[model samples]
Target: MSRPRRLLTLGHSYVVGTNRRLARAMAQAGAGEWEVTAAAPAAFPGDLGPITLQPEAGERVVPVSVHGAGRIHTMRYGPELRDLLRQEWDVVHCWEEPFIVSGAQVAAWTPRGAKLVFATFQNLPKRYPPPFSWMERYTMRRADGWIAFGRLVAEVLGARGIYDRRPHRVIAPGVDTTLFRPDRDAGARIRSSLGWMDDAAPVVGYLGRFVPEKGIETLMAALDGCAQPWRALFVGGGPLEAEVRAWAGRYGDRVRIVTGVAHDAVPDFVNAMDLLCAPSRTTRRWHEQLGRMLTEAMACGVPVAGSDSGEIPFVIGDAGLVIPENDVAAWTREIDALLASPQRRADLASRGRARAEAEFALDVVARQHLDFFDNLLMETR
Candidate 1:
């Protein structure tokens, strides 16, 4: 029997529940044909616990940390990541963007003949200077393949003169269908527990960070023009928490704000919603990469309405309404239309769920990755 091929993945986001689901799904798809080891930070940006893989997942987790969370981000792998690279492997996948110096360092340590794959969600058309640009140049020269989370991201790379230099394709990260699926009973129970049973208003939900780039302000303004009997649920915390709280307070019961919910609990919150809004707007420094919450909401059979910023329209793709970014009137109109037409909302929910199952399901995306890896291996052989 041929020995299984070894695969190493370096990423900080693996500490999140969504990425953990992907790791597990990939392991299941491997079926002894591949061995997967994920190296992750002890804690990610908003992680609540240590990085650890479930025992039965059939994958390994190597804990590593980056330096200076406040500023000057650099991988603190020391000699550990380099030592791991010395071993023979079929592939080394880095989830960080190619411009990131840390991922470039991993490429530097990787041995010859091991395919290096770089994954990125950067949609901003910006250029780096000095050592960072040099690192990006090195990755552009060395990376065997590139996986962009969205088409816009790939376009941004092309604008920066990185495409055609390496083989690349757009492949979104996957979602766990089992975890995010609709459950009316659970939804009802959660709403009842949260004192929402008495409120028959159509609820519009937002689940993500409360920051300027998220366009929460525009959502807030749209909500002000919304008619009575419509409530909004904002679930997340970030720089604009104070502003969000004040806005929610002005609306009283019409706006409910919850901060710092566990990742596992997100599904129940999503299920309680009639529609989810991801009104992200692009700034010079930031844009919506994939607007993952939109997919998660869709997976839970909740219709989504997002602004046409970055990949929101591409991600929604007829599954939900796509409003122009920062256009409060458009957001208001779309929200009102969805709230008034139950049939339209149901249709959108069905389409969104189908889209999630076909494109964002963990198994489906795992197979996509495996196929790409298999192709690369075949070419090498």
Candidate 2:
């Protein structure tokens, strides 16, 4: 007998790639019994044909297309996208971007009796321009159901009246435990690559967009306020690079900024940190919906300190400290306290590693997602 018809996922680059990792975990867990295909804007023409994941993320990309006409502006897929959606799949899911409206558009236009889901990752207010948001909401209402990455996201949608009184579920983003887990061998290599000498100062790291919403400026200010011999390292590039560099200059040779690093190298980057901090502020267009980097750091057995923005407090739990957003003084105190107590930092690291392995382990997370999708298809049928 042939394998079970399974999932078709629609998403932008990040999500599509993450879902592929889950699919791999599913395959390894004997959950591979189903057929899975992704409908994201690929670099080329056809389904990048079924291929195993390479250490290089580029090797796993599948092909897809997008038509020009749409209610939302997708990142421009080719015309082949529609036919891919019409294929026999038990469930269809749209990822973070409206790329396929997380696949609902393709599903709605497909023949009847399809289980379509829209995965909404925004915990903050939608930033899309006026009239477009109305149409976007309408398209989302058209889906069979919706998916929220976490409780905070679900609540935000619920509070903002985004959920159309339709069925929805909250399943958080996952990390690849196998690749990101604690590796003693990789730790020294990571430190060496980053140029941290025995006499080098403690490293503080941040990962994500460097835009105003990310509150990187606040981080820079807080770091400058601290008297400790510290080096701030960043793994992402954003519009505020020049400003950030200028601000760091006041602290002398205490800041190092790398434009950006690939996702596969995130573990090494976090492993190189003495502490990872996300100083995201809750603002009109801002909220750190899910602390993806913090989780990645935890997976690397590193302690993280972040603010109580959006799901961050929930994300951090008891694993690390949470200070008020935009409070440079509190930020200083938190860092100083952590630096003063190595035992506390060690405890946080242990707790963080436990949390990473228990809650967000790739295999467990993938299974939860697979079961959720499987149940949704069964119920809708």
Task: Return the TM-score for each candidate structure.
Answer: 0.94, 0.85
Tens-place lDDT digits, model 2, residues 250-281? 66656667764766777777777778999988
Tell me, by TM-score, which candidate is best: 1
Point out the worst 10-residue segment of candidate 2 by lDDT. Answer: 44-53
Which residue pairs collide in model 2, if any? 48-63, 65-78, 66-77, 66-78, 94-102, 94-103, 95-102, 98-101
Candidate 1: lDDT of 331?
A: 88
Where is model 2 more than 4 Å wrong at Cα? 1-3, 14-19, 30-32, 44-62, 67-77, 96-104, 125-134, 159-164
- Please provide, for model 1 over 1-381, each residue's C-alpha lDDT reduced to its tens digit, 9 standing for 90 to 100: 999888887776675545766667777898789888887666544444444433334458776666543332454455667787888889998887777767788878888879999888878877788778888888778888888889898887866556567777788888889999988777777677667863488888999989888989998898888764687888888889899998888877677888878888989989988899999988878888889999999999999999988889989998999999999998888888888888999999999999999999999988888788888878877
- As a whole number from 0 to 100, the lDDT of residue 8 in candidate 1 is 86
Per-candidate clashes, comma-separated: 0, 8
Worst 10 residues of 1 by lDDT: 47-56
Each prediction's Cα lDDT score? 0.82, 0.70
